[model samples]
Structure formats: structure tokens, C-alpha cells
Target: MTTTRSAADDARDLPAEPTAPWILVLAGGVVLLWLGVLAWQVAVLPERVPTHFAADGRADGWSSRNGALAFSALIPLLVVLPMPVLSRLVLWAPGQINAPNKQWWTATGPRLRRFERLMREDLWLITTVTLLLLVAGQVGIVLAARSGGDAMPTWILPVALVVFLVAIGAVMARMFIGGRYAAQPDLD
Candidate 1:
């Protein structure tokens, strides 16, 4: 009898990925919504808008409305848009993945699938949180522009920053834990 490699085994050889988890799709949707909000805000912005904020949350510098819009759009595009590309890169080049006990993970089909699922989920989580933070930033920009050098709501940025940091850290830690699972012999 000849043994044949199953489709799952062949999957490892393919450059294409399986269907994305819902969270990744959700992250993409959120970014699209953010672009919509930015466009609406740009349409309403005055000719001159505050583009920089001081340590105290008051506007310290100004720019033309177009300049402010360009700055805001450029940042999230740079920061958030690369996530899916990197995720695909990792899938295509699993050799780049580092773990304390990667041998066990790559040893079997089930373990490898589990390892990949965790990686994809963690990536989507990171992307979603980053999108949220960027959206918050754009909201602050619009509010500051409306306020005309007035102080922003004092607690908002600090609180949001801390929350986003904690959330991302937790997701990263979960990814590390996947290594632990990978190192184990399968009980199945």
C-alpha cells in the first residue's frame, strides 16, 4: 500500500492561507469605518486646524486642514495596514517563527495547525487593538480642531493608552503560552 500525503500536509507547502478568522475581518472593517470618519471630519475642518498637541493636551502647533488630514491618514496607514501582510509572510515562512520548543510543534500535523491558529488569532488581535487606538487618535484630532487650541478631555488619552497597552500585552502573553502547548506531546 502506498501512503499519500493528505491535503493538510500539502497545505504546508502552499503559499495561500486558510480563511481568515472573524477577528481579522473585523479589524479590516473597522479600518474602513475609520477612513470614512476621517473623510467626514476633513470635510468639516476649518482652513487652519491644530496639528500638534502639548504635554498638557492643548494645541501647540497648527496646519492647513489638508496637512492635518494627511498626517492622520498617513499614520494609521503605515501602522495598521502592514499587519495582514506580515501575517501572510509568517504563514509563508514558518521558519521565521521562534519558540523555545518548536520541534514538537512542527512534528505533527495537529500541533502545527494549532500553532498556526494561535499565531493568526494573536495577529488579528494586535491589528484590531491598533486600529482602535488609531481611531481614538483621529477622534482626538477632530475634537481638538473643533476646540481651537482648547484643552482635550484631560483623562482620555492617558486612559486609552494604558488600556490599549494592557490589552496588547495580554494578547502577546497568550501567544507565548502557545509555545508551551507546542512543546508538549500530543495526548490525542
Candidate 2:
């Protein structure tokens, strides 16, 4: 005997809605705010600024203010611009998506869509966090330059690294556990 399931049935069996509108809006807003801050700082920064900091948070390298500011602005641009485009590509082409159980998840429509949605949300979140961190670091550098002292708190990079690692680990765990992409038994 053989059995067939409708698309509706497959969707019903899949997890509930995975994307949240408010979260996406909030993430976008943060990136915009960071851009604004970068622009404002670039306008007001001195002729020379610290381009690098020592482990002790003291300025170790110097550059033209415009050059340093441009580098700072570039970090967020690199993260904010390509992320959404790549996320959309993944959504449209699930075959290109990478994950622990890529084959299993992309095998069925409902599962593939679900995985894509989750991955998109995760990418947005990672982009937001990364931009925020970069912005914070840039702000610290500017403030330190203005103050003529350390360009960052020595603890900032270490703490940020820990947070970044934790966030990535959590996202990966959620993808594997919540996605449940393993082969399922035949309904028939």
C-alpha cells in the first residue's frame, strides 16, 4: 500500500510561524542608528585618531581621522548590506542553505520552508548583534580619541567575543534541535 499527503497536511505538521516582524524592525532600526552615529562621529572627529588599541586599551596606532572613520563605517556596512541579500537567496534557494542536516531539511517543501525561515531569522539576529558590537567599539574609539586616552575598555573585546560565541552556539543548537530534520517514519 502507498499513501500521499497534501501540502496542507505537511504544513500543518510543521512548526508554527518562525519569523517575528517586530524583531526584524528592531534589528533594522539598530543598524540605521549605528550608521547615523558613524556619520556624526566622522564629522566631528579630530584630524588624527587612534586606529588601533593595545591589549591594555591604550592607543597603539594612529591614522588620518577620515581613514580611521571610514574603516569604522566599513565594518557595519559589510555586515548590514550583504546579510539580508544572502538571507533572501537562501530562502529562495533552499538547496544553497547550509546546516547540520541540510539534506534532510531540504527534502520536503514544508521542512525546507521552515528551515529557511529559521535561518533567515537567525541571520538577521546575528547581523544585528554584530553591527551593534562594531558600533559600540567604534564609539569607544572615538570617545577615547576625544579624551586623548585609551581607545577602548580592555575588557570590551574579550566580553564581546564571549557573547558572540555564546550567541552562535545557541543559534546552532536551536537550528538542530527545533528543526528536527531527521528522516521521519512513513505515515502509511
Best by TM-score: 1
Clashing residue pairs in candidate 1 are: none
TM-score versus the correct structure, for each prediction: 0.75, 0.72
Q: Which stretches in model 2 have alpha-carbon errors above 4 Å?
A: 1-18, 91-96, 178-188
Which portions of model 1 miss their true places by more than 4 Å?
Answer: 1-21, 108-114, 178-188
Estimate the lDDT of model 2: 0.69
Give candidate 1's error at residue 161 in angstroms.
0.4
Candidate 1, residue 165: the lDDT equals: 100
lDDT of 1 by residue, 1-188 (tens): 98986434744664443545687678768878788878877788788886667889997788888887887788777876666456444344556668556665555555556566656666778877887777777777778777755556666678779879998988777667545444645424
Q: Give the TM-score of candidate 1.
A: 0.75
